[model samples]
Target: MRKSFQKIAKKYALLKQGWSPQQNLFYGFLTYIIIGCILLCLPVSQKISAPILDHLFIATSAVSTTGLVTISIFDTYNGFGQFIIMILIQLGGIGYLTFTTFMLLSTTRKMTLWHKKILSTEFTLPNTIKIKDFLKSVILFTLIMEAIGSILFFIAFKNEGMPTLEAVWSSIFHSVSTFCTAGFSLFNNSFMDYVDNNFINFIISMLAICGSLGFIVITDFGLMIKNKSHELSFTSKIVIYGFLILLTFGTAFFYFLEPSIVNLNDSRFLASFFQCMSAMTTVGFNSVNFGVFSQAMMLVCIFLMYIGASPSGTAGGIKITTLTAVFAIMKSRLRGRSNITFLGRRIPYERLYIATSSFIFYSSIIAIGTFLITLTHNFKFEDILFEVASALGTVGISTGITGDLTTFGKLVIIILMFIGRLGVLTFGLAIWSKTITENERKVLKEDIAV
Candidate 1:
């Protein structure tokens, strides 16, 4: 009996010690969602009673930094509840690895090999970049940008005649939200009132752009400045160029396609540019009602959200890097070339594999999510598809269907938002890693036609 007890104890200890980094990331966000849900459920958190599921939905959205909501946040939650949400957004934005690593550094001033392993899994760093530099860059850059954004926002709000205390709180909340690309707004209509307000528009756009650019670009730029001999990495160059091309194209096309822009008159170009920026950055803020957008305009927004922003940042979707790599592969194949190349540079096979995997897995999620939501909701296909793309991209744009979603539809969106925040690739790895085994066997190879 004593031997059996010892055996059981040993098994339990082994189980406790065997969590992989992917597993840690997967379970870490789950814990945050649950805790945030419970806190939002407390009597002090709510201004009025609400369904537990609504609170759970909101909690999941906040922790994922996906701003989809079934209830009005202003009406549902009090100041303390809003504070809880802001904290969750901040945590989700910086990421689980960043938070844990920062805490470790604060307490121990050192990182173990295990911590390094987690960092590697969470971020896709270039060969030239160091993990230490990446972590410091993320934390420091986030602080500085958010600080600057808050001040700008406060000035804009005060100029707009908002009360001083309200402006202060709104500025802080919005600065963090915009920089994080979380898209949570204290305002009920989400900047609709300030649609033509150039100051507010500029501040939000700048914050979102900086947040969505990813830490790689920020770190690379910092290194280049610190060392004159240093140059921007290929990845950074691709991100910047791709960002500009997409932004210019999206704005011009959106301006011509969106009818409401004509109504804005003097603010027509600004409206188009801001909306495109919001979608491309995955920040999800809309100055005008998305419900009024035509199908073509909606498709344009969908494409932007689907591409999302750069990797290793708060923004979701498969990432610009993945999209670029996929295009490079297609270009190479079309040229009858044996090697994949982009911009005269031969692309690595490993990156191609990741890009392909991400594209496939991300598309599969959207299709499945849309179908599942369709099974429960009576909304139009375009509207349903938009919601799925928004949730999966973590962009949070909707065709006014979010609040009316049935419980099942909300649950489907909740799952998509969670997957988006975790990342389609990371989520896949987290699950697949659990099934990996050391034992190897040889297998016969087979070929199939494309």
Candidate 2:
């Protein structure tokens, strides 16, 4: 028996060498999903006894950091099941190996080369050379941010009359969810009751915003505060300026265009502000019924979700930096400039290609996904498009029609959520082990009108 086991282990090790970073991520994600599904199907969750599709849907939802669900989180799953889901959310949000490396570093004070390589790929870091410090920072920053968010949420909940223990639990869960931008909520309506509650809304929104901003930005901000001389990266500057502009414009647009929202005399501003933040960050926690939102508001939400938050964050969509890069490229070209510049710094061509590729790939996936989902469901074109965008953005906001989707439709969404969370390029790269070599021979060039 020992000899046979050794033989099998050796065979597996041989196959592992051919695995690319993308393949590793793909397999690791699948392992998490399978484990999540098994745990969710246990007797504790039997009362919810969702169809297999629902289990896959929720498992995919949790692991992909996409919050779309076919059932009420509070009512459908038992405490045990809810706890399991929360664990998955935490793991999926920050990533599978990020926490593991943190644990190793804390326990042993060193990261093996193999560990660093995995962490680099998982976080999309440019290199794995000095990932120990990065891992440590990620862990420490996550704890501090989540702690602050929890305390503020707890205070807000206490003000709303929740009992001490319940308030604490709610705060902790929400803090993790918000800071990870993973929109899992214990409440059925997802903070709808707290729409006018300034303390809660602001705390949650701030957490979501901070989380959606990449860790690199957080690190740079920390350096700026601590050293007082370190320069912020151009990418950071673009992200900050762009984020502020979008938030301001999106809030005003939603407030003015949606009469149903504006008609809410008491909480009009709060409602509009929260929804704007929610959609732009791709956090997906809704304070109002999306079903009643005007066509204009729906379009606005779709646009926000598509642009999404920053790169290297839990949030999905095309990402803010990518959009900013594309605009910068266009402006430079229109000006007949030799280089793309932002904040007085030239952006690298490699980064520009990545941004352009990401945008095109994201748009293509959404278009294809929308068409596929339409064939499986009887919903209106707008609603179907909204649902597909929500999935691809990892945004959970829905048209109150998710539960009515066919089994096939739900599966399609599950795949979209997985692809969205991992990213389109990463997914493609992970499945293909070898890079395609381009032919060097060039055909005669033809000039085309711009």
Highest-scoring model, TM-score: 1
Best by lDDT: 1
Model 1 per-residue lDDT at 385: 94
User: Which tens-of-lDDT digit does each residue in 1-450 have in candidate 1?
Assistant: 999999999996566348777776788888899999999999999999899989988888887888888888888999999999999999889888696787788788899887788778778898888988889899999999999999999999999999999999889999998999988998888999988999999999999999999999999999988999998998998899999999999999878878978788888988999999999998988899999898999999999999988988878878889999999999889989999999888889999999999999999999999999888878999999999999999888788999898888888888899999888888887787655345544556799999
Predicted candidate 2 versus true structure: per-residue lDDT over 1-450, tens digit per residue: 999999999987666555776777787788898899898878777555667678878988998888899877777788778888888888888886788878888898988766666566666543322466556656778889999999999999999999998898888888988888878899988888887888988998888998888776776677677778777766677778888999999999978888878888889989988998988888889998888888878989999999998877778888888898899899999999999987677888988998898889889999999999887777888898899999999988898788888878888899999998888888877875475456534456789997
Off by over 4 Å in 2: 1-14, 125-130, 436-450
Alpha-carbon local distance difference test for all models: 0.89, 0.83
lDDT for 94 in candidate 1 is: 89
Off by over 4 Å in 1: 1-17, 435-440
**Model 1: pairs clashing at backbone N, Cα or C within 3 Å:** none
Residue 222, candidate 2: alpha-carbon lDDT: 70
Worst 10 residues of 1 by lDDT: 434-443
TM-score of each: 0.95, 0.92
The per-candidate count of clashes, in order, stands at 0, 1
